[model samples]
Target: MRNHTAINTFILLGLTDDPQLQILTFVFLFIAYLLSITGNMTIILLIFVDSHLKTAMYYFLQNFSFLEISYTSSCIPRYLYSLSTGDRTITYSACLSQLYFIYVFAITQFFLLTVMSYDRYVAICKPLHYVTIMNRRVCRRLVIGCWMVTLLLMLPLFILLLGLEFCNSNAIDHFGCDAHPLMKISCSDTWLLQQMVVICSVLIFILTLVCVVLSYVYIIRTILRFPSAQQRKKAFSTCSSHMIVLSISYGSCIFIYIKPSAKDDVATNKGIILLNTSICPMLNPFIYSLRNKQVKQAFTDLVTKLYSSQGTREILK
Candidate 1:
């Protein structure tokens, strides 16, 4: 039997070892990270400042943008830093911390997406009661509930991971400190932890997916029943962006986490996860803004107001 010594740091085998690939990867990720921050931040700012965006839909969207920022920030920056500097060694505590935040932010996002689906459902199906059903107090409670539920689910796995001792192999075969990679390299018997991971993941995935699907089913049925074609078109426009975002989010996650074959293809999984972390977050704000008329209008109004104010200041000077 090999000696199992507790290690303070673990090495990350990043996306590629080729110097050229590393540079390309760094540049791509840097741009993606920059765009994601800028886009999501813009959404948050617009929602906060725009009076027209004070409804429940924009409120949920604002929270969702924040979650995207937190989730992407939790991992991508570290990976980019490693690719740039060749510093692959991450302290055990930092690794665990990364794992915790990634899971928390990601899981909470799933819940928030589910909630947003419900919000869309209410807005389309029960428009008369939408305001009463999704009041400010209820929205706040739902956001808090998502975070609480995530923490409860993650605490068990995180505590169990802390008890594990790493021995022979300290090289994680991924860019970030993911649970599966960490568990794979541990000397301890991780069967229980592995089961817990799968169970938690499957439970969250199945539950949230069911909620989203059901919400859309009702939403679609209601939209179809509209008497006028114009009304139907307008209703579809309201939620189409959300539907697209949902497809991308759920599709990527299902491929990465739920597929049995994913564990075997570590390299492919890494690529998919890179897209999930960087591209998806970067694309989401664009998706919402480009497809949303109200958001576009809000952006235009904000810019015009700023321009007029600047002109006034210049004249006064």
Candidate 2:
């Protein structure tokens, strides 16, 4: 066992050790971060301004957009700074805060995705009762409940991590502070913390995945029973975008967190985290909007309104 002492700061090794690669990485990440922020912000603004989008589906989407923005912000700016300045040192408190938020957003995303699957299920399987079942009050409650439960589940884990003592090693092999790396660096015995993380992660993944799977199963069944081919196609289209997002989200998550041997593959893990934190968020808005007709129309309408407003302002001037 290493000597017990408090660690005041931790160094992130970041994506690469090559100086040229670091500059390239900074540019790439900056562009990706900008795209993610713009895309998600556009989705949120469109949903808010368009009365036609004031439905349960769009409501959940707005929440997801906000979550993506916050999730990416929690990790990417620090990473960008590290790449730009060659300074990978993060204060201890900042590391803890980042770790706390990473867990909260990640867990909340799973719950929210599961909720979205259920919403799709209700909309497809019980079309006649969609509005009645997914009422405004219920949607609000479900969103609130997802946030509340994720926070409650992650708080204890964060508190447990805070109690740990880090001594000799303060270098994290990844771009951001995560549970496994933090555990590996700490001098104190982390068996309890590790067990808690493993158990909590498994439970969250399994429970949410089970819910999504069951919901989709029913959804597929309901779609198949529809007499009209066009109707089935429409229903399937509505679901395909979500199914794609779910697969990618859960696939990356399972590989990163659930795999027993994941720790040994630090390079692959960091690559996956980069994709998850940056690329995936950047893709989400485009995936949903391009696939959904309503969102495209809303975007067009928004642009038209902006142009018209500009014309009106010119006339007044």
**TM-score for each candidate, following the candidate numbering:** 0.97, 0.97
Model 1, 26-103: lDDT tens digits are 999999999999999999999999999999899999999999999999999999889978999999889999999998
RMSD of each: 1.7, 1.7
Q: Candidate 2's error at 108, in angstroms? A: 0.3
- Tens digits of per-residue lDDT for model 2 on 1-317? 43333778899988789888888888888999999999999999999999999989999999999999999999999999888777889998899899899878878899999999999999998889999999999999999999999999988888888788887788998899988888888878899999998899889999999999999999999999999999999999999889999999999998876676544588888888898999989999999999999999999999999999999999999
lDDT values, one for every candidate: 0.93, 0.91
> Which residue pairs does candidate 2 place in steric collision?
none
Give me the candidate number with maximum lDDT: 1
Residue 208 Cα positional deviation in candidate 1, in Å, after optimal superposition: 0.6
